[model samples]
Target: MRDPWVRGLRYLKGNLFSCPPQEALAHCISEDCRMGAGIAVLFKKQFGGVSDLKAQNKKTGDCAVLRRHNRFVYYLITKKKASQKPTYESLKQSLVAMKTHCWENSVASISIPRIGCGLDRLSWEKVSVIIEEVFRDSNIRITVYSL
Candidate 1:
């Protein structure tokens, strides 16, 4: 039998899946970015100076900041709606912004908490499909934090 998790990836059970503890995430990739698999790496974020977990960045970092949910590494992921859908160029631009930050900090890996879904009201199933397909094959390591 083979281990289901992609190499280097670990599954956190118990609190990890429920009220995951605060951890860091890496650079953000935009809607139309070329994602890498097997070759991916996820770097964690360091504290940027927030008094509380719910605190927002007073200023965007030269690199990306880590997201947290209930004191856990987290973010709500979702897909673009038809009404406010984005163009490839715009998506690419957004991704570029994130990449710039990654480059600035020399980040090689990243962790993500479902991006753009939940309460944001993006369909969970759809989000899963989009991210999987978008990041089908690349050198970038992305760890999807389960909550």
Candidate 2:
């Protein structure tokens, strides 16, 4: 279970994907759950009433921070879950997936906030381990941000 990335791969949506770091706003819905009334409303506003048709294929998109930087970069890769309380191992594995994305993009330095804390409702300590473990053996450098 220590290999959070591997475990996540097994469970993260079959069509898992990532986009290069860029500036854009995207809409999302939990494939794991039917769109609630609240989420549907937001989705419609995001895609011009497409929520009623329910045709969005990409959910939980990658969001880059607005802070301007030369080399260093940041991204928010959203994950879908019915509930916020996921096992530590799963959350760790999820971060591993994100770390892979960063590496693929030739990102040498990374700054990710306290993942699984905002809506995921995870503890910072455990989240740190998930992040630290992902980049520890790799060549890329990383710094995690949190409250």
Candidate 3:
């Protein structure tokens, strides 16, 4: 087995929608499934699975997954409501749940933005560390994109 690799682009300079067709896409959202702000709006518009994600009844520390075509879309529930803020603990739990889904389904790569650092106001430095720590033992390649 090999160590998992996580890469961040200094400038990222990529589109979330343009990631390789085979790679999975992930982003943070609230448990209420209201993706009315931030990069989440794009995710909702692109995937359009509001009812399906809500049907899962995911909580603040859970991950809601949507299988579209040949890839997966991971929705990390980091807060109880769209108006509420998310804690690092909840973020970490969501990531772990997403990782479990990835491992179970043999997903090898993910394309994501600087999750939780935009409108959510999380420190990128802290969030990045948590992401690394959670996936350290898996071979899944994580690509963190920034604008």
Candidate 4:
């Protein structure tokens, strides 16, 4: 186990999609992307499609794990309704679920954007704490991108 807060995590400022691909790319998403904005656009364009994301977002805290271009990407449903922003509790729970899935599946590394900080209107300071707390002792390496 490594201390992700100290040395296991990398914080990079760039487009999340432009970074080198990793085993997984994790980000928060609404139950539906009918509004069409944010990272959903990239997911729709580059990652095959978001139909799976739409299907999986039926419940709050639902996680849609998809394989694209031989890599895994996660869409954590932090928002229950399409119109509402995601809540901190939902984001935390989603991350916990994702962590469990990744550990069980032996995912070595994951790249993520600052989840819940953009359209969801949450604080990165708070969400970062939750992410660090969830993955601090895990063997997986994490890279959080800002764009």
| Candidates' C-alpha lDDT | 0.36, 0.41, 0.89, 0.77
TM-scores for all candidates? 0.40, 0.45, 0.92, 0.86
Please identify which of the two predictions, 1 or 2, would achieve the higher lDDT against the true structure: 2
Deviating ranges (above 4 Å) for candidate 1: 1-96, 132-137
Which lDDT value does model 3 have at 145?
A: 72
Q: Which 10 successive residues of model 3 have the least lDDT summed?
A: 2-11
Candidate 3: Cα lDDT at 71: 100
What is the alpha-carbon lDDT of model 2 when measured against the actual structure?
Answer: 0.41
Put down candidate 4 lDDT per residue, 22-93, tens digits, no spaces: 558987777764536777667767775566666664467767788887778887878866578888889888
- The Cα error of candidate 1 at residue 108, in Å, is 2.1
Q: What's the distance in Å from true for residue 126, model 1? A: 3.1
Backbone atom clashes (below 3 Å) for every candidate: 29, 2, 0, 0
Query: lDDT by residue for model 1 over 1-147, one digit each (tens)?
Result: 553355444333322233223333532322222122211113122333223322432111112234345222222111233223333333334334444544555545555554434223445455555544444443444555664
Which of the two candidates, 1 or 3, achieves a greater TM-score against the reference? 3
**Which model scores highest in lDDT?**
3
- After TM-score superposition, the amount by which residue 42's alpha carbon in candidate 3 deviates from its true location, in angstroms, is 0.6
lDDT by residue (20-135, candidate 3, tens digit) is: 89999999999999999989999988889999999999999999999997999999999999999999999999999999999999999898998999999999889988988898
Candidate 4, residue 40: the lDDT equals 66
| Model 2: per-residue Cα lDDT over 29-130, one tens digit each | 243434344332333333343332234333343332222223322223344544434456655544565556656666555533445564556686666666
**Could you tell which candidate, 2 or 3, scores higher by TM-score?**
3
